[model samples]
Target chain A: MSNTADPVSYLDYQGRHKGILGWILSTDHKRIGILYMISMLSFFGVGVILGLLMRIELLMPGMTIVTPRVYNSLFTLHGMIMIFLFIIPGLPAVFGNFFLPLQIGAEDVAFPRLNLASWWIYMLGAAVALTSLFVGGGAPDTGWTFYVPYSVRSGTNVTLAVTGAFILGFSSILTGINFITTIHRLRAPGMSFTRMPLFVWTLYSTAWIQILATPVLAITLLLVIAERTLGLGLFDPAKGGDPILYQHLFWIYSHPAVYIMILPGMGVVSEIIPTFARKDIFGYKAIAISSLLIAFVGYLVWGHHMFTSGISDTARWIFSLLTFLVAIPSGIKIFNWVATLYKGSIDLRPPFLFTLTFIFLFSIGGLTGLVTGALATDVHVHDTYFVVGHFHYVMFGGTGMAFLAALLYWWPKMFGIMYNEKWIWRSWAFIFVGFNMLYFPMLIQGWMGHPRRYYDYVPRFHATHIVATVGSWVLVTGLLIFAITLFRSFKSRVPAPSNPWGGRTLEWTTTSPPPLLNFTQIPTVTRGPYEPAPTPTGGETS
Target chain B: MKEQQSLSYGSYVLVWLALVVLTSVTVTIAGMHLGALSIATAIFIALIKGSLVVYYFMNLKNEDVMFRVMLLVALVTLTVIMVFTFFDISFR
Candidate 1:
C-alpha cells in the first residue's frame, strides 16, 4: 500500500511545504534532526566553556581565579549543560531522529510534527535554563543532581533550572512515544523485528527508557520547583518531607538517563563495528536483548548513586548488588562487539578507530563503575573525583566518542559532502589521547583523598590538580581540531558518494542527503541487517 | 492490507469511562491513608489505566505479532524497574 492511503502516514511522513517557511514550520524528521544538532552543538560549546573555566580556576588552586560562589555556579553550569543539554539529548535527538526511521526502512518517524515539537520544547527548556545566569539569585548551586535540603535552601536560581529540566523531560517523553510508535508500526514490507538492524533495536530500547524514566524526573523537578515556590514540603525535612524522596525520584530517572545517553551511542558502535568488520553482528539476538536488559537494570540501580545518603544498610547492599548486575548486559554487548570483530576483515577507518577507543574507554568506565558499585568502596569514593572520573570516562570516552564516530561515519550521508579523511583521523588521535590525559589523573587524585565539587583544595593536591588542568587544555585543543575539521569539510569541494563506508543497513541504500520523501518506493527487506553485501540474486544468504 | 475502517465511537467512550472510573478509584484509595498498600493500589490502578491507553489508544490490540512482542518487552522492562526500585525502597 502507498503511504498516502495509510492512516498512519500523517504521523509518519512530512508533507510538502515551500521555502524557509517550510523548514521553520515543517514537521520533517530530517529538518528536526538538523535543528537538534545545531542547538545541541551550541549547548556543547557552552558546556566546553564552563569546563575550560573550571580547569583554569583549578590550575593553581587556592582561589586562583573565581570566588567560591562563582566556582559553585561554574561547576553547576558545567554539570547542567553537559548532562541535560548535551549528553542526554545528544545522540537520540540528533542521530536517532535522523537515522532510526531510515534504519527501519520507514519514510519518517511515527509522529513527525511531534518530533519537530520536541526540538522546539527542548529549545524552550534550554532558554529557561540559560536564563538562570541573568536571574537575581544567580544559577543553581545544587549541581545537576539537585539533592534536596541544600538544593531547596541554596541561593541560586533553582526554580528556573528545575523548570527547564521539567520541560525537557516532556520533550524526552514525546520523542520516546514517537519512536516507539514508529518502530512498532512503520517498518517497510517484510522488515520483521529480527530482520531490523541492531541500531534500531537499541533505539527501540532507549525509547522505552525515555518514556518510563523521564516522568519520574519531571515529577522530581516539579516538587523541587514547588518547594522553592509553593512551599510544597515533599522534599523538605523540617516540614516532614523526606529528603531521601528527592534522591529517589531524581535517580529513578537519572540512572536510566545514563542509558538514554549511552544506548544510542551503543547503537552507533553496533552499526560501526559490523560495517567495518564486514560481518554480521555476532549474536544479534543477544545484543538486542542486552539493550533492553541494560535499560531495565539501569533503572533499578539508581540507589547506588545515593549509597552514602544514609539509606538503611540492607537497602545499600541491595542497590550495590543491582548496580553490579546492571554491568552484565553491558559486558555482554562489549563481548559481542569483540566477537563480531574476531577474524573478520576489520577496516581501521576513523569510525572503527573511535569504536575501538569506545570499547576500551567504556570498559574502563564500566570496571571503575564496579568500584563505586561496591557499598564499602562507594562509601569512600562517594563525593570524590573517582565518581567524576568514572562518569566522564563513560560520558566523554564512551558516548562522546561514539557520537563523533557516528558523525564522521554518516556525515557524507547526512550532508552529501565528504569530510577530509586525514583531518578526521588527526582529530581522532588528539581526542583519544587528550581525553585519557584529562580524566586519568582525576582517578589518581580521587584515590589520594581528593573530593569533587570543591572550588579550592589544599596545596598538597596542587600537583595533581595542575596535571588535570593541563590535560583539560589538551582535550579542548583536540576537540577544537574536530570542530574545525567538520567546518572545513562542510565548506570544502569534496563531494560524497551514496555509500562511503560500504554499510550494510538500509540507510546506505538511499541517496546521500536523501530526498524529502526518504524513499520513492518502500523497500522490501529480504534478509537480516549487517549481512555482508554481494549476496546471491534470490536474496538467500550465500 | 485491509481497508481502513473508522474506530467505533463506543470503544472510545467505553475506554474513557473505564479510565475515569479507575482514576477515581485510585484517588479514593490514596485518600484512605493505607500507607504502602495505598501506594500499591494507586500503582495497580495506574497500571490498568496505562494498559487501557496502550491497548486502545495505541491500538496494540489490533497490531501485528512483532508489535505485540515489542510492547510486551517494554512492559516487562518497566515492571522490572518498578519492582526492583520498590525492593530497595520497601526494604529500606
Candidate 2:
C-alpha cells in the first residue's frame, strides 16, 4: 500500500473513527499538531484571563477584585500556565510538529506514536498542575519558580505542581528526540542542513536544548518533591541545605528554557520576513549558525539569574560576561531580518505587520534585557516590576507576537480557508496598541522602584497599574477578535490557495490542509529553501 | 544501517572476563586509599566499562557517524553543564 496513492486529507483520515476520539487517539502528526494547537490555545486563554485578573487586582492601590491570598495564587497560576503550558511548548509542539515533516518533505516524524504519547503526557501534566488549585494545600503560591525553603515548607500543593512540570519536561524531551531524529534521517533528496528553512534550524536547536536541558529541571523538581516528602535537606535551611542551590538548579534548566521559548519564535519571524519581503533571507547561514550558538551559550548564562543570591564574586563576574555573549547571536538574527527587508518589495500584510511589530517589540525586549543583564542595574530592578515588564516584553511581546504572526501566516495552510483581511488588520491594531500600553508602563513603574507580586502598591505605582489594566482589556479584546476571525474562516466562502504567500518551500508546493501522506511523492529539492520569486513576464521586477 | 555481527560465545566470555578483571582491579585500587587519585582512577575505570557495554552490548560502535556524534554531543553538553556548575559551587 503506497502512502502517496492515499487520497485522504489528514483531517479526514479514518473518518470511521468519529468525533474527539479520532483526534485523541490518531497518530497522524498533523492531527496531533491540531490537538496540541486546540489544547495550547485553551491554556493560553486561561493564562490571559489570569493575567487580566492580576492586572485588575493591581489596578488601584488596593485589591479591586479578590483578596491578597487569591491574588498570590492568581499570579502563580498565570505564570505556571503561561510558561510551562503555553510558551515552552507553544511553537514546537504545535507548528513544529505540523510543519517540520512537511517542510522536510517527509511523510511523518520519525516516531508518530511517541509524538502522540507526548501530547497525552502534556495534557496529563496540565491536568495534574491544575488539580493543585483545588487539592491539598491551595494553588502553589511559591510562584512558578517554586523557590525553595518556602516551596518545601508551604502547605500549598507544590509537590503536585512540581510533579506536573516534571511530567511536562518528559514530554518536551520526547518531542525533542522525535524532531532530532526526523530532521536527521528524513530530509528530501537534495535538502541539507544549510538548505533547510530557518524555522527548521531553530527547531533543531530548540530540540537540542529541550533534550539536554530539561533533564536538569526534572531532577531539580524531583528534589523539590523529595525535600517536601522524604525530608531531604536538599534545599531546606532548617535541614541544613542551601536554598541558593535550588535557584542554581532551577535556572540551569530555565535560562535555556527562555531560549526554548524564543528561538522558534525567531525562526517564525525569519520565515515571515523573507516571504513578505519577496527576497531570499539575508545572512541565512549566519542566522542558522547563530541558533546553535545561542542555544549553546544560553546554558552558561543561567548563573546570571543568581547573581544577587549570595554567589561568589568570581562566579558573578564569569556569569555576567557569559550573559552578554548570548546577546550577540540574537543581535545577529535581528540585524539579518531587518537587512532582509531593506530595498525589497515589502508587502504590508497582517503577518508582515506582526513581523514588523515583533522586530520593534522584540528589540525593546532584547535591549531592556541588557539593562537587567548588567550587574549594577539588575541589583536595583531584580524583583521589581521592571523585571516583570522586561519578561513580558521578551516572552509575550517577542514570542507572543511571533506566535500570532505564525498563526496568521499558517492559518490558510492549516485550514484551507481564507481569513478576512480587514479583521486581520483590525486585530493587529488593537493588539499592537494594547500590547504597548499594557507592558510599557511596567517598565516605567519598575524603574521607579515598584516591586512585583505585591498585593498592594503605593500611590506612585497606581496610575501605571491602571493604565496597564486598561491595556489588558484592549489586548484581550484584540485576542478575542483574532480568535473569532480565525474561527469564522472555518466556514469561509473562499477556499485557500495551496501557496497563498508564494512560500518557497516544500510545504507550499503541496495542497492546503495537505493529504495524509504529506506530498504526492517525497519532494526532491534543487534550490535553497528561500529562492527569489520569478520576475513577471511583462518585466516587472517585483 | 549497520551489519549486525554475530559475536561468538568465546568473544562474549572474553569480554565478561575482561570486565571482571577490571572490576577486581578497581576494588584493589580503592583498597589502596590513593586519596584524590582514587576518584580519578575510579572514574577512568568506570568510563572504560561503560564504553565496553555501549560499544559491544548497545552496538553504538557499529551505528552510523550521526548517532555517534549525537551521543558525543549529549555527553559533552552534560559535561559542560556539570563542570561549570562545579565552578560556581567550588568558588563560592
- Against the true structure, what is each candidate's TM-score? 0.89, 0.94
Q: What is the iRMS for every candidate structure? A: 2.3, 1.1
- Cα lDDT tens digits, model 1, A1-542, are 12223232222334576665566577778778878888899999989999989989999868778888988889998999888988998898998999888888898998888898898899899999999988889888888888888888888898888889888888999999999899888999988989888888888888898988898788888888888888878876678888887887788889899999999899899999998887789989999999989987887788898888877677788888878888788989999999999998887888888899899999889889999999988888889999999999999999999988888888877876777778778877777777887898888889888999988788888888887888788788888888898899768937666677878888877766776667667789988888865652112110
Q: Whole-model Cα lDDT per candidate? A: 0.84, 0.88
Q: Global lDDT for candidate 2?
A: 0.88
| TM-score, model 1 to reference | 0.89
- Second chain alone, TM-score for each candidate: 0.89, 0.81
Best by DockQ: 2
Residue A232 displacement in candidate 1 (angstroms): 2.5
Clashing pairs in 2: none
Docking quality level of the chain pair in candidate 2: medium
